[model samples]
Target chain A: MRRVSLLAMVVVAAPVFAGAVADLPSGRFAPLYGLDVGQTSFPVRAFRLDVRPVSRADFAAFLSEVPRWRQGAVPPALADARYLATFAASKNPAAPVTEVSYFAARAYCSWRHGRLPTTLEWEYAAAADETRRDASQDGDFVQRILDWYGQPAREGDLDGPGSPRNVYGVEALHGLVWEWTEDFNALFVTGDNRQDGDISKRFLCGAGATGSARREDYAAFMRYAMRSSLEARSVLPRLGFRCAYDDVGRSP
Target chain B: MRQLAFALCLVSLSAAAQGEPRSVLALETRWRTESGEQVSLSARKGRWYALSFVYTSCAGTCPLTTQKLKRLDATLAKAGKPLDVVVVSLDPEHDTPEAVKAYRARHQLTSAKRWSILVGEQEQLRTLTMLLDFKYSKNPESGVIMHDNAVFLVSPSGEVKATMSSLDGPLDEFVAAVPAPTKGS
Candidate 1:
């Protein structure tokens, strides 16, 4: 594969009985985007999330069993040109899979009896560190993630350091790959300061920072901007996803 | 040499046509028509149509979109295609049969048999929007919805033939994309 061996180095992940889903508690947090004009934080329900992104080996097996989702078999409307191109290039059994489109990711999660996490659910989990649950404001932590994001992608570069197990024991929330959220295309904000709606025009005038709860959270902004730039059929080399289960009420 | 060249040209043409018809019609959902009749995209497979999304209570741009569709319907009818325009309600939860009927009455579309209004759950709408690459979002508190001001033309085989912004742009190109009416009505 042009991406070399991602399944081996990208995120083997830690062994913390993380195989079982992590039951995240419900809470309200203002996202980088998607808040109403007068609203601050939207309510997030308690949901069970996979501790790590779905890996290449898991996807390879899925492709074998579900031939419809395999390369060339998927409809052009459901996946872009480069969908699953890496799977054809090389085989990395354990590293996380990349180049799966949002539709493909949803199909995969559905095959496992789960669904892609909502943007709020994903952001709520991703905003954590080793000690505190929401380390988004921590300068060093955010800087570390930003540094990783700044790096030019190189083959074999993805092999270690899976964003340090967060408070919820979920790893690779960042510093690995961008993920597909269930409502990734729900919001249609332009990359510039402009957002849709009459209220947004009035409220988000001049700088777009006022629209978000924390204007300082640039990392979340970048993520949201990246998501806004994508279509449901887009597939990228640095994109992967995990699943969330609504059936599991709370972690035991 | 002539036969070889002809065979190669035929190969290319066949290759271009060999793929699943990746269009909105492929997605399956039980959408209730304005008359409360359950129908899916497959029900509209025999003819070409214009597709767009709108809600009855939209205070902002839906009325303009509806007006544009009316013009587009007239232009196509004049062009002899008389393609039907199918509009799905983005706010399926609020747009019940009664609301759809009221919308038809308000728009003076009660007699326009060619215009079909389909109301389905948000789940199917989401799926169809993704396939069409159409964007839409509703603010829970404000009840304000932001959506793409777009319209699409679909072929009888269920593939999108052309697209244009409903809020702007002339219908000349979009009209040209619609297939001519087949023989025998």
Candidate 2:
């Protein structure tokens, strides 16, 4: 067997987002954004939001419209109809679709005239706070996130479009299913390879101790450890993705 | 701010403990191989092992991974050397010994002395996988197993030496890396 070095130059395009809506406060418990190694804040204009997660009904429509999406037509590994959670059986057509791979999700996003959100764009949206945090200090931005997560999701669930504004006016950041990012290797915290090293540099939303934070925090370490264990291919039922479109003027 | 700091401390301690390899954490407490035998990393010490985590009902890369392992086994046999192939089931509740036996036969894994399929409690599987940095999650609605697809090669001392694409293409590199047993064994 040939030993091919796992080293390949990962050419990642910058995340597409609109202009800096506001410089929000960092989450109290979360790591400060842009503190990570090799962190590059992409031009915000490239990302157009898909406010909600893709639903079962949405994918069913896709399957019907796209011949390649039919069972047995796509990659054999992904050809199972069971991949799409049936809305009729669950009676929750609005629930995020489950059992789909990053590959399948990417295909769906491409078919829908959009692309998956990059890790930077996803974290910025989740951590952004328009009112209390965005208007105040970066610490306040972090505090708002802590406050949001502190309360029961059902109680604090923001409704309507403008109820709770993020830096970019996006809402429902934390409560939604873990969104898929376009850069699969974007958040590597620790490991043997340079690819892993590069990911750690983009640590924006994950809980971890930066050079500024006290290094002895146990909770921060656990969060970072869990983050490090993640691989691009691992998918969970609770994991769903939102689409992003390159704003007409900003796409490269 | 004080409370947040304290919480962060607790998280870091737990994460640090998890990151450090807990040598005393026994694998036997967590899982058993397909032969209904308890498995422990310590038990397999002093031999190079190929490890893959899979479930029985997988219609995707799991079967392909198994076939790849079998091909690696054949290559090893041809070289007059033998290697240990350990397939740890990610779906322990459904992948019972009987189910594994059937899977083994279906895959024509008749040469059992060199290969072993193992399943154990979910907690044990989780612990072992975490130690190896293998990520897996169960889909609650469909009960499907979602996991990373990399095979680990463990050194004779039971530490992971390298991770490879699959068992087939990287067979020779892995075989070369394993330390040959001492004479008069």
Indicate the residue-level lDDT of A20 in model 2.
Answer: 26
Per-candidate Cα lDDT values, in order, are: 0.75, 0.53
What is the C-alpha DockQ of each candidate?
0.16, 0.02
Residue-level lDDT of model 2, residues A1-252, one tens digit each, is 010110011012112222122222223223322233343222343356665666655665565556565444544223223443332344344456554545567678878777776554565455445543223235554444455333333521222222254555565555544556664332333322212222442343244455523244332233343334333333444456667776543432
The docking category that best describes candidate 2 is: incorrect
| TM-score of the B chain in each candidate versus the native B chain | 0.86, 0.79
Q: What is the lDDT of residue B77 in candidate 1?
A: 84
- Give the number of the best model, judged by DockQ: 1
Task: Give candidate 2 regions above 4 Å deviation.
Answer: A1-143, A146-252, B1-29, B167-169
For residue B65, model 1's alpha carbon misses the true position, in angstroms, by: 1.2
lDDT of candidate 1? 0.75
Q: Every prediction's TM-score for the first chain?
A: 0.83, 0.57
